[model samples]
Target: MRIAVTGREGQVARSLLATAPSGIEVITIGRPELDLANPASVLPALAAAQPDVIVSAAAYTAVDKAESEPESAFAVNAAGAGAVSEAAAKLGIPVIHLSTDYVFSGEKLAPYVETDPTGPISVYGSTKLEGELRVAAGNTDHVILRTAWVYSPFGANFVKTMLRLAETRDELRVVADQRGCPTSALDIADAILAIAARLKADPDPALRGTFHLTGTGEATWADFATEIFAQSRALGGNSATVTPITTAEYPTPARRPANSRLSGDKLAATYGIRLPGWKSSTEIAVKAILKNAI
Candidate 1:
């Protein structure tokens, strides 16, 4: 299957390109070729790719920065996403769009289901929620996969940030009150490919909706940081002591959800796909990153 993915250099897109199965052809376009912020560029570029399916993987992901640039976030995450779905609808293909856990208010004590009411706390989350709405409205054959705490060896994510910080600091302060699943981009890519291949052969209406796709387990930023250090130490890299802090202590321009955990029951029931545990995936990614460092 030919999969046209947006965001050439993003973690998910990079993982998609690297880990696609033997029969799948993954083509990524970004910037000048297909800028999400520019709706005019969507149709022509997507038409030329002539893909069997489209993976809308790109977005304005800067959580804190989005507070200061809501317009830019809306343009890319909302309007641009809608345009991609519209173009996919024109080609009569399925679309797999990546969403986030931030759509929730994070007040829920338990994990969030697909039907949970959305209450985004940040501009980034609000824009992403709008994107989800637009994509659903624009295309009938769409799968909105909402993931959380995504990190990979290829992108600027929490894992890399912690490792980079450890290079100079002996102690790192991370928020312990916040809790969510830490998903791996590689696992997400595998899940996307499986869904795409299944949809290509049979576009089941049962599979066309928002589903939570994340790692099997959950963790706070502090716990996540601790594990990162553990993995780094095992890989012969620098490790730091993770000092637990509250969200208030490390305030940003945007307010993060205290709890953004999502349930994966729907995805497993429908697709029989489940990502690895957070620690397992983090270890693999950390090892890979450290290997390159050496």
Candidate 2:
């Protein structure tokens, strides 16, 4: 089957390409070929690819900076998604769009389900939520997979940031108040492909809805950092003492959700797919980073 991936050079896209799924032709479109900020780029790109399935991994993910650039965020996340969905609809193809857990207000202590009402606290969250709505509305065959705290070997992410910061600084502080599953982009890419492959086999209208996909475990930023550094030391990498701090201690332009944990029970029961624990996924990412560094 032919599958076209947006944000082709992104961390997730790169992983999907590296771990290219079996019996599938992967077409990657990035930056100059298709920019999410430019809505006009989406349809033409989709038409050019003429893919059986379109996986939109492209997004304006500058969380903190999004607060000041809400217009650009909305344009890319919302309008851009709408364009892709509309184009897919024309081609009678199914679309898989990546979303975020930030769409929620972060009030629940437990894992978030797909049915929960969203109340975004940040501009980035609001924009992504808008994108989800537009995609859902524009296409009959659409799947919005909302994941959180995504980290990978391919791009700039929290894990890389912590690792880089820990190198020069002996002591590091990370926010402890917020919690979420640190999903690996490679895992997410696998999940997306599994769903896409299934959809290709049997096009079901019932499968068209928003679903949450994440790692099995959860942790705060501080806890996650501690594990990262601990693993780094075990791997013979640099070691740094990571201190815990509240979200108030380190403020950003965008407000982060306190609870970004998402439930994958639905994904398992429906798709018959299970994701690995954060530790295992993080280990893979660490190894990849180390290999690249060497």
Candidate 3:
């Protein structure tokens, strides 16, 4: 299958390029070719790529910075996402759109299901939520995959941030009150490929819809930090003491959900796919990032 993923450098897009099976052709389109911020650039680029499917993985991901740049976030995440979905529909192909756990208000006592009411508390979250709606509306063959706490060796994610900070700092303060699953971008790449395969095999209406796709386990930022440090220490990389702090202590311009853990049961039931536990994935990422540290 020829899969055209948006953005050549985003974590998920890079992971997809790295992990795609030999049988499938995964192309990463970016810049003048397929810039999300430039809607006019989308359709022609995808048409030229002639992909069997599209993976709408790129977006304005700066949570805090997005507060000051709502227009840019909406332009890329919402309007641009709609453009991609509409492009896919024009080509009569399926589009797998990556989303976030922030769609929820985090008020639910348990892990969120696909049916949970959405109440995004941040501009980033609100834009992503809008993107999901637009994708669904734009293409009947769209699959909106909501993930959380994504990290990989490829980008400026929490794992890399912690490692970079730990290189000089002995301890790190992380938000402990906000609970969510820490998903790996590499694992997400694998899941997206599998979902794309399912989409290719049959026109199963069951396969297309909003679903939660995250790591099997859950953790707070502190727990995730501790896990990263454990992996780093084991590999003789930079490690730090994880100091637990409440969200209020580390406030950002964007108000994050206190609980953004999303359940992957629906994805498993629908596509028969599940990502690895976050700790295990974190170990892999930390190893990749710190392989040459010693």
Candidate 4:
């Protein structure tokens, strides 16, 4: 089936391009030719591509900057998403959109379920939640996948940040109070492909809805950083020490969720896809990064 992937240059999109499944006929559209903010460009691009499925992976993800640039964030995340969803609806095609766990306020003690109430604390989260609302409103045949703490071998993420800092610093401080799972972009892409194939084969509009996608285990930012350093040391990269700190110690413009864990049970039950443990995926990612550095 033909699939058009937006935000072709992003880390997750790059990973998707690098490891996309065979026989999928993937077409990528980046900026200049297909700007997400301009709703006028969306339908025309969709018409030209004539894709059976559109993957809206493009997003304005500057969490901290979003506090001051709410308009820009909403323009891309909400308005842009609405455009794509509208186009897909017009053409009788399905859309698979990416979302975030930031939609939750993180006040809950347990992992967030699909049906849980959304209460975003930051501007980024609020805009993303708005985007999901618009996309779902525009089309019924759409899949909104919410993932968190995503890291990848190809993009700018926390894993890479830790690796870089480990090279120069003897010790690094990471927020231990904030908790979530570190999901790999490769795993997310694979899951997206599975959902796309299933949708292609089944074409069930009712199967489309919001679902949480994350790694198996839960961890804090400090826990994740410590694991990264440990893995990097195992791979003979760097052995920098990581010190745990509270979120209050490192304040940013955007307020992050202290507990961002998401439940993948619904996704597993419906899609029959199991996400691998974060540590296993991190091992593979760290090895790749180290090898590339050599």
TM-score (C-alpha) between model 3 and the true structure: 0.98
* TM-scores for every predicted model: 0.99, 0.97, 0.98, 0.98
Candidate with better lDDT, 1 vs 3: 1
Lowest lDDT 10-residue stretch of candidate 4? 199-208
Candidate 2 lDDT tens digits, 210-259: 88999889999998989888888888777689789999999888888999
**Cα lDDT of model 4 by residue, 219-275, tens digit:** 998888888889888777996887888888999999999889999998898899778
lDDT of 1 at 228: 97
Candidate scoring better on TM-score of 1 and 4: 1
Cα lDDT tens digits, model 1, 140-244, are 999999999999999799999999999999999999999999999999999999999888888679988999999999999999999999989987899999999
Q: Mind giving the per-residue lDDT tens digits that candidate 3 earns over 81-108?
A: 9999999999999999999998889999
Which whole-number lDDT from 0 to 100 does residue 235 have in model 3?
A: 80
Cα-based lDDT at residue 174, candidate 1: 95
lDDT of each: 0.95, 0.88, 0.92, 0.89
- Which candidate, 1 or 4, has the higher lDDT? 1
**Residue 216: error of model 2 in Å?**
0.7
Model 2 vs. true fold: TM = 0.97
Off by over 4 Å in 4: none
